[model samples]
Target: CTIGFGSKAKNIVNEDMVLAKVLRSQGAIPLVKGNLSLGCLSYHSSNIIWGEAKNPWNHDRSCGGSSGGDAGILAAGLAPFSIGGDLVGSLRVPGAFCGVIGYLPTPARNSVIGCLFPTETDTLNSE
Candidate 1:
């Protein structure tokens, strides 16, 4: 799964986020980890990764961010599904670039109480 925050950040696991918790309750297994832009801070760059996540279709191109890693894994057939957080297009951009289905619910439609950085309050205007 592609975690939306940096690995060093607090509460970076799926269990810490409400959406992931719900998914886990429904029988989802996180098999692979994907890289993301630092602190969900950059959408145009993937430089924060240990090794940047490249597009599955074209290794020279970006897989998109901050959820780029999730999209990359999905495109590479490493994961059946992935959960990603988006403030602008973290989920959508990566999915589009990777040629997979990506969904971003309205801010009010889901709970983001435990998501790292860019908390629900931080993105109150995004909806």
Candidate 2:
């Protein structure tokens, strides 16, 4: 399988990301990785840093964001599963656009330690 992260936070995979560690422990192998916008704000993945991640269905269509790359990879059959974050439909929106399944856990259900960006602060609602 493959894994993708929101560009707003940790763009690269590291040991600090708990979900990556958990998935590795479960025997998942990292295959392909995709690109996203700089700060997870853009709908397209045409960032200068990593380039664009296009929709598998149609090159002209958007894959969605900030988890757009993740959904795109899954839709293209590059991976069976992917890990991504959401703070206002970041995960769900991409999944819908790509015609794949997406899931977001409740804030209390999972830990968000390493996934948080440096500028992030505790809020009344969790992203």
Candidate 3:
């Protein structure tokens, strides 16, 4: 799996993210990083590095943003599941566009220990 270059990912972090660790424990091995919005904020999936993420159902349609790659990959049957940050429908929009399940867990149920959300924002507002 190839990951897109989202701005947040540019920050150097040697350790795996908390989500990655949790997934690994369940026997999920992340193959590679997937595409994402430029700044992790966009309704479209286009980026300079990997280009635009298109809907599998229709080439011309958008697969949605930020998590578009995740939805695109899932829609294409590449992976069973994927993790994406959702702030302003980043995950749900793509999931809906791609005709997949986009679940937003309650803030208290999920952890954001290794995430790099904007400092001024509340992690609870995201999924």
> Clashing pairs in model 2?
none
Stretches > 4 Å off in candidate 3? 1-12, 118-127
Worst lDDT run of 10 residues, candidate 3, spans 118-127
As for candidate 1, its clashing pairs are none
What tens-digit string does per-residue lDDT give for candidate 3 at 1-127?
Answer: 2234544346566787677787899999886555777777787888877888888999999988877988989999998888766667888889998999878766645566666672223333324
32 in model 1: Cα distance from truth in Å?
A: 2.4
Q: How accurate locally is residue 75 in candidate 3, as Cα lDDT from 0 to 100?
A: 92
lDDT of 1: 0.70
TM-score of each: 0.74, 0.76, 0.81
* Range of the 10 consecutive residues with the lowest summed lDDT in candidate 2: 117-126
Higher-scoring candidate on TM-score, 1 or 2? 2
Model 1 residue 112 CA deviation in Å: 1.2
TM-score winner between 2 and 3, please give it.
3
* Highest lDDT scorer: 3
- CA RMSD (A), model 2: 5.4
User: What range of 10 consecutive residues in model 1 has the weakest lDDT sum?
Assistant: 118-127
